[model samples]
Target: MSFSKSFLVGIGTGLLFGSGVTILCIRLQRVAREMDSLSNAIAELATQMSVLAEHLSTLRGFKQRKKRNEFYSASSGDEDEIFEDANLSFISSDSDISKGSKNRSTEDKILDTHVLFNKVEKLFEGDEKNQEEAFRLLSRSAPQHSADCGFHWRMSKACYLVSKIEKSRDNPAKAKDFLQQSVDHASSSLKLDEKCSSAHRWYAISLGSYGEHLGSQEKIKNGFLIKDHIQRSIDLKPNDPFNHHMMGRWAYSVYMLSWMERKLAATLIAAPPEAKIEDALESFLIADRLRPTIWKENLLYIAKCNIELKRLDEVAKWLEAADAVPVQTKDEEEAQKEIDQLLPKYQTS
Candidate 1:
C-alpha cells in the first residue's frame, strides 16, 4: 500500500510541476521497480526471521534446564525447583501516576498493585463468569500502576477473554465491542513499550478475531498487519509456546483460503499473506514439542493440519494425543469433541 502511494504521489507531483512526461515516467517507473525489489527483500527477511524464531525458541530454556538437571544430579534430591521473579519493576508506587495519592504508603501501593495483578491473572482460567468479573475490575481499577504497560496488556488480555466468552455465547455485537476494547488497550500497551512481546501477541489475537467477522475484504486489509505483529511477538518471545501456536493458526488460516477468497486477495491486497500447509504443520509440531499436551487446541490443529495434508497416517496419532489431554475448560471440551469426531475415521481407515 505504501508502495502504491509513493508511486502515485511521485508521478502526480512530477506532472503537476510541468515535468516532461517521458523523463518523469521513466524516473517514477524506476522508483516503482526499486520499491518492488525492496518489498521482496522484506519478504525474504521475514522468512529468515520465522526460521530463526523456530530454531532459537528451544535454546532459550536449554541453559536453565541444564543447570537444574546438574543441581538435581548432585543433590540427589526430589524437591521441585523454584524460580523467583526478582524483577518487581512494575510495582512502582512512587511513580508520577501516584502523585495525587500522597497519603498512601509505598508498601500499600505495591501491595494493592500486586493484588490487582494477581486477581486479573487468576481470572484467565476460561471460566466465563470469572472472565467477566475480571473485565469489570480492570475497567474500574485506578491503581498506581494504572499507566504501566503491564497493566494495559493485562487489560487487553481480560478484554480478549471476555470477547471469547461473548463469542461463545453467540453475542456477536457484544463480542465485537470487547474485541475492539482489547485492541485499544493493546495499542496503549505498545505505545508504552514496543518491546513487550505479550502485548504484540494479544494485539494480533484481538485484531485477528475482530477481522474474522468483518468479511473477506477487511480480513485481507488487516492480514499483513496482523501477521507482522504476531511475527514480531514470536521474534521477541520465542520460548513461549502460545506464540508458536498462534503462528501455526495464522498459517493454517491463510493456507486454507478459498478460491474466491484468493481471487479477492489477489485483486485487493497489495501483499496478501501466503503460507503452505507444510509451514502450518511445522509450526504446530514445534509448538507440540515445546510443551507437549499444554493446549488441547494445539494438538487438535496438528491433527487438522495432517488431515489437510492427506497424511492420514499421522492424523490419528495427534488426535489420540489430543484426546489424552485432560479437558479443563469449555474450549478444551469442544476441542475434544472435534478430536473424537476425527479419531474414528482415521482409526478405521
Candidate 2:
C-alpha cells in the first residue's frame, strides 16, 4: 500500500469520529431541554395540587361545622363553642332569622335569631295547623344571603328541612317532588358560590336519591344521570366520604340496572352471555366500605348484594342494622317490609 493512501485513510477515520461526537452532543442537548420542560410541568402541577388541598381542607371544616350547629348560634366566636349543641336554632322559630341583607350588624343578626327561634318553637310546639303555618312562614322567610354561604352548608340545610317535610307528607310522589325541589335549590345555590364543596356533595346526593326514586317507578335512564352527577361530586371533592357513599350507591344501581338493561336487550337481540356477577358484587362491596350503614340506601344495597351473593348471615346482619337505624320515610318502611319477607327464606336455606 502507498504511504499517501494510508495517510488519507487515517484522516478520513478521524473526521468520521468527530462528526459522530458532534451528533451525539446535539442529541444530549435535546434530551436535556426535554427534561427541563418536564420539570416545569411538574412544578406547575404541584402548585395546582397545593391549592386544591387547601380548598378541600376548608370544605371539610365546613361540613364538620354543620354537625355541631355552628350555623345556628348568634355568636360567630369560637366555632367549637357555638355548635356544641347537636340541634341548631334553625330548627326553632326563635332562632331563625328572616330574609335580609348580610350587612346587618351583629346585634341585628342576633335579634333575627331570637325571632326565628320563637317562630320555630311555636311551629313545633304548636298544633298541626300551627305547624303548617309556621313551615310556610319559615319557608317564605329563609334568607337570600349577600355573602357566599358555602354551597354544601346552605343546600344541605335546605335539603334537611325539605326532606323532613316530605317525610311527613301523605304522598310518596309528593315527597319525591320535595326532594327534587331541594336538588333544584341546591343547584341554584351552587351558582351563588361554585366553589362550595358541600353544595356539590348534597346536590349529588339529592340527584342520586332522585334517581333511585325514578328507578322505583321504572324510570331507567334517569338514574344514570344521577350516577354521573355523583361522579362529578367525587371529582370536585375526592376526600369526602359522603360523596363517595353516593358514588357507591350509584355504582350498585348501575350494576343492577345493567342486568335489567341486558334483559331488555335480550328481548331485542341475543342476550349477551351472563355478565360476570362478580362485577356487581365488587361494586356493592365498595359501597359497603364507603358509607357502611350511614344512609338507608347504602344499607339497603349492601343487604341486596348479600342476598344475591347468598351470604345469608351477612344479609341477616345487614337487615338488623337497617332496622336499628331510623327509617326515613313510609317508602323506606315498605321497602324494609319487603326485605324482611325475603330474610326468612335466606335463613331457612
Candidate 3:
C-alpha cells in the first residue's frame, strides 16, 4: 500500500509541473506581444518628432522671408490682381440692371457692380475684420446685384471667400453658413448660364467644405453630390489645374475614411462613394502636370498618398518638390508646415 501511494504522488507532481510550464510559456508570449506593440509605438513617435522638426525649420524660413518682405511681393502687385481676376472674373463683367429704378440707369448699376467687385477683390487680401466688412457690403447689395447676370458669379465668389475666412478662424459652423450662401449664389449663376465652369467649380468647393461640418452619415450622403459637381467642373474645364486638385482631395478624403466610419456610412446610405489611394495619386499627378510649381499642396498630398501605400522611397522626391514651391498665402504656409514634417522622415529613412 505504501508503494502504491508513492506512485500516485509522482503522477500528481508531474501533472502540476507540466501545467506550470504551459502557463509560463503563455505568459511569455503575451509579454512578447506587448513589447512588440511598445516598440511600434516608439517608432511612430520618432517619425512624428522628425516631421515636427521639419515644420519648425519651415517656420523659421517663413519668418526670414517675412523680414525680407518676400511673401508680400509674391502675394501683391499687378500680378496678384491679374491672378485674382482670372479666378473671380465671373463677377468682373458689366451687366445691365434687370430692375428699372427711376433713379438709377442701366449704366449706373453696371458701374456700381464693377466698383463693388473691385472693393471685394482688394478686401480679399485683408484681415478677418476686412473680410467681415466685405461680407456686409456684399450682403446689402446681393439682391440688386443678383439682378445683374454678372452679379450672380460675384456674389458666389464673395460668399466662398467669406466661408474660407471663417474656416481659417476656426468657426466651422459659421463657415458652413457662408458656404450655403455660396452654393445658392453659384446655383443662380449656373441657372443663368449652364456653361459657367467657375460656377460649377465654386459650387463643388462649397459643397465639399460644407460636408466637413456634417455628421458621418450626412457626409457620406453629400459625398456623391460633391463628386458629381467636381466631375462636372472638370468636364467643363479639363485643363483647369484647380479642378483636378479638388478631385484629388476628394479621393484622398474618401481613402482615409476608417472601416467603422464606412460601415456606419453604408448603413445610412444606399451606396456610398468609393475611392482608392491610386486614384488620388493619379489625380494629383495630373494636376501637377497641368500647373507645375503653382501649388505645393499637390506635391505634399502626393507624398501622403505614397506614404499610405508604403511607397517610402517616392515620398522623399515629392516632399523635396514641395519644399521648392514658393509659399505665398496662408494656405500655402499651412501646406509648407505639413511638407516640413514629412520631409525629415524619408530623408532619415
Candidate 4:
C-alpha cells in the first residue's frame, strides 16, 4: 500500500510540472509577439519623424529664400513701395507704377511656384496621404503659372510622382493617365525653354513610363523617341545622377525584351534601338558611382541587370548593398521586400 501511494504521488508531481512548463511556454510566445509588434511600430514612427523633419527643413529653406528676395526688392528701389501705396494711398496714378506692380506680381507668382515645388519634392519621401496632399497643392498652384518654364518642369515632375503613387495603389490606368499629363507638361516646358534639362529628363521618363503601359507594337514605335530624349537629357546635364539612372533603366527595359518581342518589334517598326545587358550594367554602374547608395532602386536594378548577365557574384554584391539602403518612400519599401526575397535565394545558391 505504501509503494502504491508513492507511485501515485510521483505521477501527480510529473503532471503538475508538465502543465507549468506548458503555461510558461505560452506566456513566452505572447511576449515575443508583443515585442515584434512594438518593434514594427517603432520603426514606422521613426520613418514618419524623418519625413516630418525633411518637410520642415524644406519649409525653412523656402522662408529664407523669401526673406532674401524681399530684402533684394527693398534695397533695389522705391518702385515697389510706390506700387503698394498706389492702391492704398492713391498718391500717384502713374502708369509706370502700375507696370512695376505687374512685374512684382509676376515675381511673386514665380516665388510661390518655387516654394510649392520644393514642398512637393520633399514630400516624395513621405506616405501616400502626404503625397496626395502635395499633389493637390501643386495642381492648384501650378496652373496659375502656366507660362513659367520652371513651373511647367516642376508640374511634370509632380505628375510623374503622382503616377508612381497611383501605380503603387494598383491603379495602372490612372498612373498611365498621369504619365501622359507629365509628358504634356514637360513638352510645354521645353517649348518655353529649350535648354531646360529637367524638362527633357522628365519628358523622357514620362514617355518611357507611358510606353511601358502600351502594346508591344506601340513600345517599338516609341523606342527611338525615348532613347533620343534620354540622350538629350544626359547631354544637357552630364553631372546629374538621375539622368544616368534613367539611361540605365532604359537599357534594362530594352535588354529585357525576349527574342519573340524583338522580332515583333522589328516587324512593327524599322530598326528598334539595340540594347544589351552590358550597356545596362555600365549605365547603372556610372549612376552608382555618381550617387552611391542614395537610391535603393538603383542598387536593385543593378543587381537585376547583373543577374541577367549571369554575373552572380556582382548580383550578390549589389543585393547586399541594396539591403543596407534605408527605406524612405513606399516604393523603396516595396523594393526592399523584393530584395528580401531575392537575397536568400541567391546568397545560398
Estimated TM-score per prediction? 0.68, 0.48, 0.63, 0.67
Give the Å error, residue 318, model 3. 1.4
After superposition, the stretches of candidate 2 with alpha carbons farther than 4 Å from their true spots are: 1-138, 146-180, 205-224, 235-241, 258-297, 320-335
User: What residue pairs clash in candidate 4, if any at all?
Assistant: none
- By lDDT: ranked, best first: 1, 4, 3, 2
lDDT of 2: 0.50
For the record, the alpha-carbon RMSD of candidate 2 to the native fold, in angstroms, is: 24.3
Poorest stretch of ten by lDDT in candidate 4: 74-83
lDDT of each residue in 1-349, candidate 1, tens digit only? 4656667777777777775764777687777868775675566456545544533432333223322211111011101111122221221222532442343355345445555665555565437788788888877884545577777877887887888788888998998898898899889888988988878887887788788678776778788888899888889878666777888889999999998888889888677889999998888888777666555788889989999989888888888877787776776778878888889898744
lDDT of 1: 0.70
Best-matching candidate per lDDT: 1
Tens digits of per-residue lDDT, candidate 3, 126-194, equal 666776777788889876866543456556667877787887889888878888888788788778767
In Å, residue 62's CA in model 1 sits off its true spot by 21
Off by over 4 Å in 3: 1-119, 125-130, 148-150, 167-173
> Which numbered prediction scores highest in TM-score against the true structure?
1
Candidate 3: give the clashing pairs. 51-341
How far does residue 250 in candidate 2 sit from its true spot (Å)? Answer: 1.6
Model 2: lowest-lDDT 10 consecutive positions: 70-79
Instruction: Sort by TM-score, best first.
Output: 1, 4, 3, 2
Question: Candidate 4 lDDT, tens digit per residue, 1-349?
Answer: 2334444554555567797765665565455556655565565456545644554554456544322221111011100000111121111223644554555555445445545765665564356676677778878876577787767766776787788888878998899898999889989988997876777777777777787778877777677888888788788777666677778888888888889988887888878878888898888888778667656888899999988888889889889988887665566677889999999977745
> Worst 10-residue stretch by lDDT in candidate 1?
71-80
